[model samples]
Target: MTVAERKDISNYLNRPYNIIIKSISDESGDYYVARVLEFNGCVATGETREEAYQAIYEVLEGFIEDMLEDGEAIPEPISDDEYSGNLRVRMPKSLHRDLSQAAKLEGVSLNQYLINKLSK
Candidate 1:
């Protein structure tokens, strides 16, 4: 179907997707940077988080629209039904006990401690 016949732009745009926002400040001033993770070079910046978010969203919409108009392919947003962000791992009981003890010593949940350790 043609872009116009597919669905409303706003409706099509409203979905869960990864957007990475960062704060950039220096001696000059503060700036908020935002970008859709899967949008390649599409990005926007503003003075505040809200402003940056709106700017990035608009940029994302425009990017998608332009891609559609040009007959270019656009990746779909993250589907809400997928990616539950939960996982199960099996390890020796001794390892589990050691991790729990370490977590207690660190004063953090096992999950949090593991995440911090793994991320480093």
Candidate 2:
């Protein structure tokens, strides 16, 4: 890779991409898996949680490098300001009617009822 490409990867690596770590228990033993939310299919696994966290960065570097080499646009981590807190969903009419009735019974608007449900 060129110097400029390497530098670009370094800059993105420093960005605050969300890293999610989940623990799994299987017949072999317990292990931890880490994935970068911003980079689909970028994942790492290790015996310990800390190891999984560290491994994710290595995987992220590789993902960024590969994306750069392929001339694919690298996705930047989304900032808080980017979300407008509005989501439109399509559901079956029956489900919608049920939800509306439940919301009415609870003395809340459908939006507020959905928010309360999602928060839990």
Candidate 3:
């Protein structure tokens, strides 16, 4: 690969892509699995959380490399700033009416009531 290509991959690796690590236990015993959310099928596992994280980082490196070589578009990380914190959800009219009545009984706005319920 060209130096330019290497640099491009390096830039992507430096980005703060979201990584989720979860503990799992099976007949094999307890371990941790890590994956990058942006890269589908990019996953790795290890006996420890730190090891799992390191393994996932290494996996991401190769994953990005292969994607670049294949001329696939790389997905950038989405920062929290991109979100407005306003979610628009569609619910059945009956449910909406029920929620409104409940919120009214609780002496709170429907928005606040929903927020409180969701926070739980």
Candidate 4:
């Protein structure tokens, strides 16, 4: 869920990366997790959402600092806005037929139906 403006990341350091926050609670009391998906294994957790956010931000800052000190390249976030909105996916003919039928039943175009499903 992180993205810097497409090619306009010159001043992105002031605007923090958008991190993903989710509930990781599983009946062992409430808890939350946060992560910078653009950076593999950069994750943090806390008992509350606010704590998780702060923890993840700290981790992100440290991660960046470490990379800079180590002379490693800092990865920029992948922005979806750069996409052309066109993708060619190859699938079985039967599956395509089924999807077309389903889209027809839902009163929506197949492309729209696929977009809706993928967005969720």
Best by TM-score: 3
User: What would the per-residue lDDT of candidate 2 be over residues 30-53, giving only the tens digit for each residue?
Assistant: 999999988889999999999999
Top candidate, metric lDDT? 3
lDDT (tens digit, per residue) of candidate 1 on 1-120: 565634755664786657889999889699999998778998999999999999988998888788877988777775657778687999999999999999999999999999899899
lDDT of 1 at 38: 74
lDDT (tens digit, per residue) of candidate 3 on 31-100: 9999999999999999999999999989999999998888899998978898999999999999999999
What is the model-wide C-alpha lDDT for candidate 1?
0.84
Q: Mark the regions of model 3 whose C-alpha exceeds 4 Å error after superposition.
A: none
Candidate 4, which segments miss by more than 4 Å at Cα? 1-13, 105-107
Model 2 stretches astray by more than 4 angstroms: 1-4
TM-scores of the candidates are 0.60, 0.84, 0.89, 0.73
TM-score (C-alpha, index-matched) for candidate 3: 0.89
Assess each prediction's global lDDT (C-alpha) against the native.
0.84, 0.94, 0.95, 0.79
